[model samples]
Target chain A: MPNPTAAILIIGDEILTGRTREGNAHYLAGELVKVGIDLRQIRVISDDHATIVAAVRELSASHDQLFTSGGIGPTHDDITADAVAEAFDARLDVRDDARAILAAHYAARGVDFTPARLRMARIPEGATLIDNPVSGAPGFSIGNCHVMAGVPNIFQAMVTGLLPRLTGGQPLMSRDWMVMVPEASIADQLRALAETHPEVSFGSYPFVQEGHYGTNLVARSTDAAALEAGFAALQTAFPEGK
Target chain B: MPNPTAAILIIGDEILTGRTREGNAHYLAGELVKVGIDLRQIRVISDDHATIVAAVRELSASHDQLFTSGGIGPTHDDITADAVAEAFDARLDVRDDARAILAAHYAARGVDFTPARLRMARIPEGATLIDNPVSGAPGFSIGNCHVMAGVPNIFQAMVTGLLPRLTGGQPLMSRDWMVMVPEASIADQLRALAETHPEVSFGSYPFVQEGHYGTNLVARSTDAAALEAGFAALQTAFPEGK
Candidate 1:
């Protein structure tokens, strides 16, 4: 069977405004590949309700799993929970389960759970909580969409806990060969090799060093034999490659 | 008039595979903000033909301008040119202008202008070339979509030359303040402040350093006076913030 496919939707004005560099999507992409989930696409959008709702609906329906980061905080700009609810057409409020988790955590620290703080507990009607080890507030998985925090540390922690619960396919394996040659010189052969090996994916990344062009040729596949065969064929075609 | 809105579409398989981290989008986002272009959305999709065609059409039509990076090289994986052509319903061929640039560059270097090398000359009809200072292969702009190379150096070089030609609004300005307070404590006040100043965009980025939660409050606006007034209100509301 094919690997489970996923997409990441990021909601934040800070990212769109370039105040903060987006690392969550990159982090998730790396982690997803390790877990054998193919990250099909990533969408970074601003904190607009209509845009968020539309993206959530579109990505969730298209991919097997849709993971979203940002806008789950206590601030007014954190409207992802409501937007997600609207996307799935689910009732949203301060659900009792989420509220219980936040209440105890804050009470233990001698902090009052203000109305604004309680906004973090506002979850969709039907959703499973994804544990956040770093923060008291929890992320939720409603249908195929998993909503997580924007903070990198918190987002990573949530993903660590959430990934294991979902079913994954065999991890993709890859082999790389570098050669000091322009990509055009080998493009014809590379194309033929790629067409012959449908099970493997061929990638050619070009770089220039000391006025010489080099291509990092990579072959990736979930099937072990196919990966080995494809790599062998690639090596044969470019004997000078190493 | 509002700032010209733009979207970025990244076409690559390496990004989705986690083999490469996407930095072009971040770099361009920062540059666009300085030039007064509001970057609305960013989409990173695979090098699949159908997906590329769809995204090119969607992003190009939705925003005032669409910038695409990657898949313009000579390798088999490089099919962005064809996909873009299909999206715009333009006939793609080895245009003489682009061919002359590549032919002269290669001839000077004693490199053969093979069929594969000539693939770099293929341009969608009616497109103007975006100069590539680092490489001879040129990016093109057609139907409000500017196609650029995926290489970081090439992409940035293309953007530098392309931005000046497009119309821009007033440059956006921002003010940031860090406060050692939970966002919840300031959320209510922030919401009120934001409602009072629709001209400025209020962003609250939360962090947990040590055991204390802190928030970085940012106010951004194209209007200088609006930005100043909004920031002043924010300071008045959170007197302890600094």
Candidate 2:
């Protein structure tokens, strides 16, 4: 079978307009990789229903799992829940389980649970609630997609709560070798090696120091032996790694 | 007329893996906004042809302009040029202009112009070259889509060189008003205002201070007068500005 793959949907105008830098995608990428799920794509869209609906439909069909961050807040622009529910043709209403969680959370904080705060309790039909410990707003899992909060702290907490429940594929293993050789000089050889190792993924990152530019070669694969073989070949080719 | 909008495609695994914090997207978003182009979407994809091609095709069709950062270097994993060429159905070949620029750059730096370095000269057919002052690998513009170097320094320089050439739309104007009121209490009022000003985009950013959470309300639009009017009304609703 092919490798398990995942995608992320970031919904917020704050991110698109550069008002806020997003941390959820990067955090989720590493988290998914640890569980052997390759993060295939991440799309950041404004909190528009058409955009969110289109992205949700496309990503749901392509990846094994889809995690969405943002737009599940209590404001009017937080229409991701409604849009996602519409995308799946699922009815949306306040869930008893989610309401209980939010109510309890508000009580603990000595805050009144206003009607507007109930917006967080509204979830799609037939969706599993992803509990949030950091805040009262609960995330939900519908089909292949998991909808979470836009707040980085809340989103991270939701991911931690959700990761253990899902089934994962093989864990990805990786190794890196830093070479002092200029990237251009080793382009042909690296290309050849990349073609030879079809199962492995190799990447080169160039860094400049004291007016000299060199590259660090990273090879990753689920197979430990193949990863080692790829790393060894890379090291042998660029022995001066000095 | 609606404001001209642009989308960004960030191509690199380093970014998704959290190995490299992205500076290019943030810079590009600000530059696009300053030039009166609304940044609509941003998608970060790995060095995969199918993903890059699909994202480029979708974003290119939806927005007035599309920009791609990273994967234009002279390394093996730098497949963005080929993918973009294929996406546009344009042939990729060593352009004489790009070749001349890279050749002259290498000569000036006293670095050997190897065949692998010639890979940097490859450009999509009918593309305009975007000059790179930091490094020799030149960025290119194919139709409305601008492909630039991924390195922060080089990408910034290329954007400065390219932005002057494009015709801009009505500059998007904005006004920020901080509210001490909780988002929940203002949800109803904000929703009513949002419905009234259908053309303007309003977003709420919540922040925590001394264990108290409040929100900053930002109203944005291409119409300066409308934005100011909306800001005035919004501030009146929440007179106690925090």
Candidate 3:
């Protein structure tokens, strides 16, 4: 059976403006790969309602699972929840359960539960909350979409809470062989070898390190035996590491 | 006039599988912003031909400029040039000029111009070559789309060669103010202040550092005076920083 495919939608202007570099997509991609979910695409868009709504609807329909990060805060630009609700045509309001969670957490810190703070409690109808162990504001999962916080720490915590519940296929395994040869010199051999091992996916990444051109040939497959065979064949083909 | 819009399409399976963390999108975003080009969106897709072709066609039509990175090598998995040619409905083949460039470069190093090496000479009809100072393989530009190498150094060199030739608007100016206060506590104030400075764009990024909650308010505008005024207003409103 094919692995379940997923798409990530990153909503933020900071990323587009080049203010913030690291995001939840990288971490989520690694985690999803380990859990046997194929991450097919990742889109980084601005904090706009129409764009977010369109992306969410489109990605959710195409992929088995959809993950989103950013725009779920208390500020005016945090419109992810509302956009997601609009995408699913679901009613959005402050739920007692989400509100209670936030209220208690804030109360423990002696912070006021202002109306703005209450915005975090607003969730789409028929959605389950994804726990945020680091922060009180909870993320939500609606339909096949898992919405998480933008902050790296909170996003990681929510993903930890959410990934295990979903069904997964066999984890993908990868092996790499580094060769000190130009990719052009080995392209034909690599192609022939890849055709011989049809089950393994081959990727050739060329690099220039210390003024020396080289290529890192990576082989990935869910079957351990196939991966090992492909790796062994690659090693034999370039015995001197070139 | 509004800034010219641009979109980036990153073609690689390594990114989707989280095998590689850094890519060309971040570097391109910062460069585009510096040149007054509004980066509207960035999409990272696998090295599938149909997917890359569709993305190229869509992004090329939607934005004023489209930049693509990856899959433009001699390896079997490198199909970007062919896919881009299909997207533009242009015939792709080894052109004499491109072949001459590669032949001369390889001859200097005493390397054979193998058929695999010759694959790098394929160029879409009616496209102009973008020089790669770091490597001999030349990138191409068809219409508003700029196809570049996946390697960071080569990609940077190609971008440097291309960006200066395009028309650019005024560079965007930005100012940031960090306050040690909960975003919820300052959401209303932030909204009001944002409204007062209608010319600038405000973005609130909340963080938790050393058990303290804070928000970084970033104000961006093409007009330097307006950005400074907005930043000053935010500082006055949150003098205590909490």
Candidate 4:
């Protein structure tokens, strides 16, 4: 069976402008891998509504699931919720459930839940809200698209709560070996081995650590036997401590 | 003036698998900022030729310039050169100048330059080579798109070499003030300031450092005076030292 696939849409000016370093993509990719879903693509766009809307539609149509991070804050650039609504052709409104949750969360901290704070309660019509365990602002899911906050802490908590509910496919497996041989000298042999293992995925990453010419060969497959066989062949090509 | 914009296409499977944490986007963003070009969007796609071609076309059409990193290695997964050629309706050929450079580079290192190494010398027709001061395999540019190696060191060197040759607009300037205020509580006041300064782009980023409800207000503009004035107003809104 084919692995379930998902794409990440990181919508924020901060990420694209190099003002913020994104850790959410790595977190989401790791979590999705654990749930047997392959992260097919990751697109980081500015907070422009058109770009967000276009990316949402494109990724949602291509992948089994889509997760977006950023641009849902109560500021001028916080237009992701509206963009998602427009992309799905749905209406946006302040959700009562989300409001109550945010109100209770704010009340617990002795902060008044103002109208601007209610912006976080807004969700696309007919979408299911994913509760944020770290912050009161809830993430929502419309069809296969999951929209979450850009804050790493809040996004991670929301993902942990949402991942268990997803229907996963075959788990991804991999094996890796480091070699001292130059990449070009062994490219033809590696390509032939790659063709031989049709069920497996092979990657050769060149590295120059401490002024040494080496490459890391990794093979991934769902079939354990085929994966091991491919690894064995690759190991024979380059012996250790050479 | 509108911010000078550029987009990035990260072509690699290593990124999707969470095996590699990318530093290229950050490096390019910083480099572009020095050249007064705003890095507006960055998308990471698997080393699929069709996907690369499609993304290159889409992004190049929308943005001022498109920069691609990775998938130009001497391995089977390195299909970036072929994909870029296909994207621009050009043919891939081993350029004589590129071959000479690579051959000389390898000869200097006392390494035999094999045919597989010749794969690195291939360039899309009607493209200008982007020099790799550190590595021998040069990156090249076709139209508004520049393609570079995925390795951080090599990619950085290539982009640095390419930046000076490109024309850029005014540099975008920014100033930030750390405010000990919740986004909801200060949203109205910040909104007023933003409205007053139409030329500057203002952003409020909430943070919880040490369980404190605070936000960082960043004012950005192409006009240095407007940016500084906006920062001053934002700082006045928040008292010094809590």
lDDT of 2: 0.86
| Cα displacement (Å) at residue A35, model 2 | 0.3
Q: Model 1, stretches more than 4 Å misplaced?
A: A210-212, A239-242, B238-242
Per-residue lDDT of model 2, residues B156-186, tens digit only: 9999999999878887677888877678878
Model 3: per-residue lDDT, tens digit, B94-168? 999999999888898898999998999999999999998777989999999999999999999999999998877
Give the Å error, residue B144, model 3: 1.2
lDDT of 2 by residue, A1-242 (tens): 66678889999888777777888888988888788787878888888999899899999999899999988888898999999999899999998988999999999988889888998899999999998887677899999999998777778999999999888887777777787777888888898888888878888887777777878888888888888888888778888774
RMSD of 2: 2.0
| Candidate 1 positional error at A110, Å | 3.3
Per-prediction TM-score to the true structure, in the order listed: 0.96, 0.94, 0.97, 0.96
> Per-residue alpha-carbon lDDT of model 1 for B1-242, expressed as tens digits?
88999999999888888888888999999999999999999999998999999999989999999999999999888999999999999999999999999989888888888999889899999999999978789999998999999989889999999999999888899999888998888898899989999999899998888888999999999999999999998888777788
Report model 3's TM-score to 2 decimal places.
Answer: 0.97
- Indicate the TM-score of model 2: 0.94
Residue A56 accuracy (lDDT) in model 4? 94
Report how far off residue A196 is in candidate 3 (Å). 0.3
Q: Write the per-residue lDDT of candidate 3 for residues A1-242, one digit (tens) a residue.
A: 99999999999999998888855888999999899999999999999999999999999999999999999999899999999999999999999999999999988988899999899999999999999878799999999999999988999999999999888888889998899988988999999999999989999999999999899889999999999999899999988773
State how far residue A3 of model 3 sits from its true place (Å). Answer: 1.1
lDDT score, candidate 2, position A6: 87
lDDT of each: 0.93, 0.86, 0.92, 0.86
- Sliding window of 10 residues with minimal summed lDDT for model 1 chain B: B233-242
